[model samples]
Target: MGFSTDAIHAGQEPDPATGAVSVPIYQTSTYAQTELGRDKGFDYARSINPTRLALERSLAALEGGKSAFAFSSGMAAITTVMMLLKAGDHVISSANTYGGTYRLFVHIFQQFGISFSFVDTSRTEQIRHALRPETRLVYVETPTNPMMEITDLEAVVVICRERNLISVCDNTFMSPFLQRPLALGFDIVVHSTTKFINGHSDSVGGAIITARPEHGERIGFAQNSAGAILGPMDSFLVLRGIKTLGVRMQRHDANGRALAALLADHPRVGQVYYPGLPDHPGHEIAVRQMDGFGAMIALDLGSLEAARAFLNGLRIFTLAESLGGVESLACHPASMTHAAVPQEDRQRMGLTDGLARLSVGIEDLEDLEEDVERGLAAMKS
Candidate 1:
């Protein structure tokens, strides 16, 4: 089956008992058994749930992985991945990853004796240079959150293979429809299903898909032990949201291109960062790895005041956090998303105060353009 087919029907089969089409949410906390020791495939909800399993199987199929694990949130999935490492294990990650990821690495994991090196993974040599004997993993976020940075996944995978290190790519920005990092040889692929996979802002969830059985079994154990699994209800919602992913992403792509072009030409727009743009630094590599240039776009307004003025003027674009939804959202990364990183570190990664990340949605192009124009107009001297 193709990607669209798999999204809707892969792990979702007609209910064997009820014959209903949608995968039924098995909401019970425990399952019945014929004998004291005899059991069915599931024993407790923390270890497994039918609905969450359906969603996990769907995500694994989409990412071309052997197995997938569902988590309470994106951070939970990330924490499970880090649990694969012990204290003193080192990790190399993209410098401009999601703020929550950075927070977990420095504030949380670092206290446990694990260390991290923040590098520009777009430049493979930076990743290569940052490696240490204790480095157990290479983490990447292509079209990275807010900044829209891209990492050459194929090349990074090659480096990981040669170094005998694990490679994990956060595919939240460009969901499996656009890029399959596992197919490109990444050991693991993680996603915040709260974004594109859910499409609606109604549910918060996360997933981890792995190509190898060893990795899958270990993470599965951690998922059960940590008890951060996604509930059956949210799992059902995410699965429902994914049924329309193919169509939603198509509209998102179109709107992203249209808006990026509009802002690129605007007098107040300083620099637009979008993979679809030919001049974007990682355009060629992105062209090779991703099926499409997703809807995430970031732009510069030349000054912090101008960016805020534009954000305040927007009517259709809600000034809020989170992205990859059906409605447009605009936010200042310096204050909202990437604020946890120290000011000096944020600046080092080019996260300027004036930088605004736009999650273009499936809306009328003219209306969306006008909303952006409202922002541009407000920034006028």
Candidate 2:
């Protein structure tokens, strides 16, 4: 089946017992057992839930992964994957990554005896140079958060294969609709379902999909043991939201590209960072890898003061930390998302104080352009 039809009907069937169309939320903590240590299909909620299983099955199929695991939040999913590594294992990650992920690598993982090195993954040579003898994994977020940096997945996969390193890609920005990293040779794909996958801004959840059964088993053990599984209600909501992902993504792509073009011509905008823009540094690579340019755009206002003014002036686009929701959001990555990374490191990656990351919504293009114009004008004022 094609993507749109799969989005709506995959892993979803009429309820066998009640004949209900929607997947019912199995909210109980524990399931009835016929004998000690023997339960019906589910032994406990932590081990599994019907609603979450439906979401997992659907997402796994969508991403072309062997298995899928859902978590309470994106960070939970990330932490679980990190747990698969031993204390002494080493990880090499893209320098321009989500702030929380950066902190996890720099601070939390270090305390556990694991070490990490950050490098620009877009440069294949830099990635090759950064790999150490102990490097167990190479983590990357293509069209990276805030900066819109594009890493060549095929190149990275070749390097990883040569070094026998696990390759993980965070697919939140483009979602599976725009890019499927697994198809490009990534071992694992992670998503913050609170974003595009959920679409409605109604749930905070995360998912990890892997092409290898061994990797899935390792992550699954950590997910169940750590107990960060998504609840049944949230799972059901996400599943419903994903049904319209194809339609919503089309609108998002249209609005994002239009906004990028508008901002590129605006006097107040110093620079626009979007894969859709032909002049963008990553445009060629993005065109080669992705089906669409995706719904995220970033603009530089030339100064922190101008950025603040623009964000405060926006009326329709809410100033928020999260992205990829149906409603538009504007975020200051220097302060909101990448604030945890040291100032020097952020500057090197082009996450300047004046950078404003916009998650273009499915709103009408005219309204969004007008709204952005207001912000641009305010920046000039």
| TM-score versus the correct structure, for each prediction | 0.99, 0.98
Using lDDT as the measure, which candidate wins?
1
lDDT of 2 by residue, 121-162 (tens): 888788888878999999999989988999999999999999
Instruction: Kindly list the per-residue Cα lDDT of model 1 for residues 57-113, writing each as its tens digit.
Output: 999999999999999999999999999999889999999999999999999999999
Query: How far is each candidate from the true structure, as Cα RMSD in Å?
Result: 0.8, 1.0
C-alpha RMSD (angstroms) for model 1: 0.8
Clash totals for all candidate models: 0, 0
lDDT of the candidates, in the order given: 0.93, 0.91
Q: List the residue pairs that clash in candidate 2.
A: none
Which candidate number has the best TM-score?
Answer: 1
What stretches of model 2 exceed 4 Å from their correct place?
Answer: none
TM-score of 1: 0.99
